[model samples]
Target: MKTEEHKMKKERWEKDMMLEHRRIEMEEQRLQWEQEQEIMFCDVTTMDDDQRAYVLAKRAKIAKAMSASVGETASGESGV
Candidate 1:
């Protein structure tokens, strides 16, 4: 029937819209991740020995803190 056909078309259109929205969201997330990666790893090769060591140490400290926070949150003791 025409009504059933219209209903099927509307459902397909809705599903297509949902897929497009998800694709856009994923693309935005990917872009944000790329930006963060660039910020975290910007041209370290041009730095001198001490500068490189300082950067490495700072990154390690940040990573440690992040892991600790994640652990706390996972255990439900985030201390917020």
Candidate 2:
């Protein structure tokens, strides 16, 4: 026994929930990919400075894309 106005409001709420559900689903998928990638790469913290430097130099582009801001601290940590 819903009024016409109430029916329209219900429909709008349903549509909004549907769109929000889709956005959350997409974000979950992206996070899964990131976790998988992290597992595939070697752990740099355990490597010596020289080895870390070599790996860092070769992977500079990947770091850049990940928004890494290189500086003095990085130099100390990455020296090979």
Candidate 3:
């Protein structure tokens, strides 16, 4: 029947639209992650010695805090 065929076409179109939106969202997220990676690993060769030292210190502080948080979580889970 023509009505049944029309309904099927509409459903397919909606499904295709959702897939396209999801692909666009995923690509945007990928680009955002790449930008963050670049910021974290930017070229130190273009920075002065003081700037490099500051960046390294900042990163080390973040690392220490992250490790401490992990240890806290593990101990809390074990009822310690």
Compare the candidates by lDDT and give the number of the best one: 1
Worst 10 residues of 1 by lDDT: 32-41
**Residues 14-57 of candidate 2: C-alpha lDDT, one tens digit per residue:** 99999999999889979966764664486889989998887676
Whole-model lDDT, candidate 3?
A: 0.78
Summarize candidate 1's per-residue lDDT along 4-72 as a digit string, tens digits.
999999999999999999999999979966755664687789999988887777677757766897999
**Residue 59, candidate 2: alpha-carbon lDDT:** 67
lDDT of 3 by residue, 1-80 (tens): 99999999999999999999999999997996675566567788889999999777766765676678688887885312
Positional deviation of residue 76's Cα in model 2 after best superposition, in angstroms = 52
Best-performing candidate as measured by TM-score:
1
Badly placed stretches (over 4 Å) of model 2 are: 43-80
In candidate 3, stretches whose alpha carbon ends up further than 4 angstroms from where it belongs are 44-80
Instruction: Assess every candidate by TM-score.
Output: 0.56, 0.48, 0.55
Where does the lowest 10-residue lDDT sum fall in candidate 3? 71-80
